[model samples]
Target chain A: MDSENLENINQMLEQDAELREKIKDQVTEFDKKTRVMTGLLNKIHSTPTNQLPALLDSVQPVLYSCSDVTAEIADLVPANQFWRWKDTWCNSLRNAVFVATLIEFLRSESLMTIQQVSDILGIQPSWKDRFVLTAEDYLHGVISLVNELSRLAVNAVTMGDFEQPIKISNFVKDIFAGFSMLNLKNDTLRRRYDSLKYDMKKIEEVVYDVSLRKLAPSTRDA
Target chain B: MAEQPQTGSLKSRTAIVVVFETFRNELDEHNDRRERLIKNSRDVTNLSKKVIFLLHRIMTEDEPTPKPNNDRASRAAAKGREKLKEVQNLFASIRGEVEGDRFWRYQRNVSPGLQEYIEALSFAHYLDTGALISFNQVQQSLSDEHGVPYFPLTLEDYLLGLSDLTGELMRYAISAISQRGGRTIAREVCTFVRSCRADFETLTPYYKELRKKQAVTSQSLQKIEDATYAIAVRTSEYDLPPEMLDDVVAMVSGS
Candidate 1:
């Protein structure tokens, strides 16, 4: 009975080792594709989003590859959430990050220059904003997103870097809204910045009160 | 009728073809550039994310080094405080000898009106640092540092160093004025007491405004006291000016 039990345990160990080797190869393949897609998407983002197609015809291939990779990885892993301890190098987190990154890349490609962006939305351009601040419409839209992100990032870091699916979904919504704002579809979405406008009004009130009080002594002394 | 149909169709077809081709070429160029930038930026962002992940894995997952003892840290901090006090004392002594002589000489040159500003500064310093420092101390520090005697410094030069003066003297004078019962020194300080009251009153609005603005700056808070200081000090000691006190009080109070 003791000899038979030892044989069973050894057989289990051998089977586990073989399974891990197979999983390892799959993870490597996933990693390679992720990197390739990441690189191509980065190039896409670097171009002035509007003039992007003039540079090359590389996007269709990358888009096709992304779709294929997503399918292959889905089949390779069960539950599609995270890499097991043995497969920590590949994960659902990686896939989500990649997809989000592509979304941003698309945004950068479209909103290349503020002037071109501003023209689409039909706003007066100021020389100071263009030359001194170097602000274009697309740039301003990007800044708004970045500011919102940094505000949330601080809280996320303090909360042990835990992220829920809701956070990712919110990011997608914001990115979509931002692109719309860059184009002609901004009228309804413009109300989202109403709070900021309200805050600026409060600032103006305080500044006015400060100047008044500051002059009080001189006024009285005179 | 046959000739008309042919020319009309030819013109329309050529115009349509030309417009479509130009539009297509322009769009192709725009899309290409946009895609490249997006791809490049995404990669950089991804690389940063990966690098951060790698570093975090190293720092948190790797074994941690032990921290030093808290008792030892406290003892070291105490020693540092003592060393700092020693350095400040040394500077104070050197400062006194140098400023005393320089201020004494300048005292002879200024009008009696301006002379009080220097004295007020000295008295204010004494209240603040408990070091019995004065305006003369400032002149002496400069004179001794550079081995120059009685070199006249400009009013701008004097104002530039209002930090050291304000840190200690301003608080001392304001508090002394508020108390109003210390002695002859206190009596002299009381002349400026109205100013302090006015400043405290003025500060309330500024505080509310700052909160409303979601902003805070040192200058705004100091305005109240500075206004009071000017009004109280400017009031004549023996004789009150015509309606000036009422105006000053109103101003200081920010009414």
Candidate 2:
């Protein structure tokens, strides 16, 4: 090899190693934040429906810390390499979105929008930086939220919150309708969306069981 | 499109919704293009495999005996050429759908097929001309039939494919070892593989996949050397006297 070629190879090797090390650090930070968010979300899963707001409030500090680390990751990753590392960082954001949306559903009995989740997570709309999460990433997060809500609907009936299942059933069906309008080609997201129908079906079953027995919230509360 | 939301939350909500709608459209188009490219490339890969099989048959039937009128091997070579043409056509269809940045994005989908085709084409070229096919020759053969710009195969794909071509050459060397001029063929292959290994070492740092392949290429070169050494030892056993036998063995083994 020529001396020029040898010099070029040396430079490239150094650059590749540096980029890999930086990405590893960012991925580690993202993983740590994701763990905190998952821990908080698990608490919501076990907490009773009526006491969800209080449970969420207790984890408020952790939510801010998770988002802070996410922002740091966004700043650290270069724009061009974002696609390669997207699955890693977006997975972390997906967990955060899942928990934030669940907290929103419990508090207002309504669907949480992407903007709301971003607000909850303290994520800046880093459109110019371009390393921040996209709406599509949050959509994936919402898809996971739909899956969790289906299980929540069944559990709510057992917890004597029959009315919550009705709200969840409606919210999930609405999200499914919105998703169906999109021409989705991402196989992973498409497959996940296909299972939304099953979640809708399960929620419907829970709603039917509650209604037929007059065990719904309106009747019991009255 | 009714638009009356001036509040910060509502404005950002609208933006997110609009962005997602655009993103979904882009994803749909990208997936469609990717799937189409993969389908065409797989056809190319299958055809290329058939071409390699034909080449293997041709080599197997080629013997030193006076059966020079054996039409079957030539017929198989002819059929392999036709299959290679079909591969070129299939690749043309893929090239039509992808260009510029799209080519780079979908490269991973078609790279394996392209590399396999390269191995087959190079093997066939070597058999016919007793010369290594150049990258320019591969490019010229793949010229677009539709009068469009010729699709140039990326150097990365070509080099990767050429690396795999060594494995095919290794297989050929192993089978030819029992025939006349077999040791020479094995020696030539060992030299070629060693040169390829040296060329790739300079490129390894830039490509992680290439680094892995270079390691495999080194092992392949070693195997060819070992095979030739066995042939030399066996040949020397018959021609040399006991005192001279040890010296001949040492020379062959050292080389």
Candidate 3:
């Protein structure tokens, strides 16, 4: 090959490397915002359920700022090349997703849909020629949400909220049953799914402890 | 402690089930597509390897020295080109599977086979023309009848594949040097390999794996230089006939 041809190839590769460096910078900024949100959410384990609304309200500004950083990341990534640079930011994105899912659950005691998570993160849900949240990332986020909920269940009982454990137990079981319907391959998702049963067992034991002591308020009161 | 909360929980539970059902379908479709691409890539790799082997056999079968216009050399090039059609067909069959954004999604699954195909194609090109194939030429060969490319050719794969070509060239040069009237071809290959190594050195820092492949290229260059130097030394020392010199060089190189 001629010298000009080799020079052109090197130029293209150098451009790709430069773009990656730019994207990585934005991802680091995105990661910093998520860590702040995670620190705020960690307080939910100690706060009583009645006080959760105020805690979630405090996270809204940070979450919006996180979405702003995500926009910067989206602008840096070239079209149709999300998967090429995905490795740089996927773990941080998954953590952001988990934070969003947990906040939604604490606000309404319901699971967040993938579309809703995408809306919160201000990214597209479609896997086309744009920056998008992949299904694998969403699933990983939900698995992490389950893990956090189990920890919440144990701490809720410690705070004299016996009924919260029962709710978390039932919700976790329903989510586990949903995961079972999936035909998972032997990948990172499968390994995470396999470890999910331990979390399920932990939540189940919290429910068992509360029920054995008749700590739940009598249903006749309804 | 209200009946409304129980009903609300039941409603959300059903919503969770429906949402996960949709996720299951999406995951299944993705897994199936990935599996298909992986299988096709393996088939491509196998076919490309056979093409490389076929070219090596045909070009070196009976000729003591390769000539640009030799009847056997042209026949060997023709046979290699014909065999490569099967490898091309394998690539064409998977073109739709990697269309648009999907190409980047499954690029890892496709890269190994694509790199092997590049190696075989460039080696064949070198055998026919006695020169390195250009990147555009390799990319053009992967396009369709209307000149539409199946997917963009990655520069990393093209470079790595060419690095592998040095190994084959080393084998070809050493084998040829042991044959009668093969000294000129050996010196020519030595210069070509040296040029390839010098050019590739500038690219080592940009590609992580290319640095590793560069190590292998250095070894190949060393062997070619050593073999050529031995021949030069022996020829300068003795004015022996070509056939006897061939035996002496062959015995000395142990090839």
Candidate 4:
């Protein structure tokens, strides 16, 4: 490959690792918050009904924030590749179900509302579909950066992995589910991300601008 | 003469009422139909469970006495039964939602469906990359992988660019309906818009092609549009920035 094509191909692979890493971070965050909420759910199960809302309130932020991000992360992967999430998407998808159920539970006055659970579960596929595409651009790009070193260990030709290769693979079974897409040529990808060496200088500007924070938060802002 | 003048005025007034009533009735009708679609989807989903229960009962029953030494037939029957049951349920659930709702609700709800559809976008990317290299190999070597080039100049990317032409027609229809305020045209526009969402795969390549062609084609198109807008509306030509509006027009035209 010419230097430019090599560069383009390299950029593609780099973005893939970056995307994976970003998702890993988000997933870790998701797991941490969910573990806390899961424990809280158990506590609420025992607490008097009157104290339940307070209990639920504490987890609500976690659920909503986690969900919003997971949904955002879901954008990183394709809805069709819901499988790439492997166990991660499973937990988060279920977590979303639980949170959605919690929302229903709150409204149901605590009577074990399967209706809400089922409703959330039913809509799970739909929600997954909507958020998957947008997420992949973000996901693959971030994952590539996180694993840049691991990638270069191999060669692009006859190599198991490229130092930075662009990929978007889907398990046919997951053909209809999540973002399994990976590409190096997508110019419009990750244009919205406001992070990196560049955004570091803008941290002070971001804090004072509430609207900016609302749209996106740095690791520090989150 | 006075009577004729009164008749004309009365006819005009009635025409006005008819126009007003058509819009009012159409909007109300659309609203009612949308509600019905939602309710029908719910009812179908509920009905699916009952059907599943019946299928399970039938499947669990003892096999027929004639048990043709092979279990394959019976097993295949059971599997088919299960699959059919799922299909029936799926259709029941989505039937109303897909077929009956008015245009606005469809637009609102359709985004979720579009999201799902677009999520598989990487597949297209993968295919394009693989095909590009494979076709290049076939053409370069004239090897057994023999065939015309994949996504050749006039093939893959061409259709991709051409879809932009359709999208422009779509935008024009939308603006026309919005400006004219009649369901007759609006209904057609609604189909155009919904097709943009529902049948995206059919359009994806075309849209992709259009996007590619945009780089070269947009400059001229924008100049034409800007000049037209400047003269027709007597607005400042500078208001519509060339690069921005050109792409916007290209995108709108593609959809």
Candidates in order, TM-scores: namely 0.23, 0.63, 0.91, 0.26
User: Clashing residue pairs, candidate 3?
Assistant: none
Report residue B231 deviation for candidate 2 (angstroms).
Answer: 5.9
Off by over 4 Å in 4: A1-9, A78-87, A102-222, B1-255
lDDT value, residue A50 of candidate 3: 95
lDDT of each: 0.36, 0.70, 0.82, 0.37
lDDT (10s digit) by residue, model 2, range A42-157: 76556687687777787667767776666666666554345445655677778877766766666765556666666666667653243555657777888888898888887777
Best-fitting candidate, scored by lDDT: 3
lDDT of 3 by residue, A2-59 (tens): 8878878978988898998898889889889889889999999899989999999998
Write the number of the candidate with greater lDDT, choosing between 1 and 2.
2
Alpha-carbon error at B171 in model 1, in Å? 34
Candidate 1 docking DockQ: 0.02
lDDT of 2 by residue, B189-243 (tens): 7777777788778777667788888878887888898998997788675965543
i-RMS values of the candidates, in order? 21.2, 6.5, 4.5, 24.3
Put down candidate 1 lDDT per residue, A159-221, tens digits, no spaces.
Answer: 433221124223433443343332221243333332222222222222222223343234435
- The alpha-carbon deviation from the true structure for residue B117 of candidate 3, after best TM-score superposition, in angstroms, is 0.7
Task: Give me the candidate number with maximum DockQ.
Answer: 3
TM-scores of chain A across candidates: 0.38, 0.86, 0.94, 0.42
Candidate 2: list runs displaced more than 4 Å.
A1-14, A45-79, A107-109, A112-136, A154-160, A180-191, A213-222, B1-27, B43-107, B117-162, B171-185, B194-223, B230-255
lDDT of 1 by residue, B162-185 (tens): 322232233333322211121223
Off by more than 4 A, model 1: A53-60, A66-96, A99-101, A104-222, B1-255
**What CAPRI grade goes to candidate 3?**
acceptable
Clashes of each: 45, 0, 0, 48
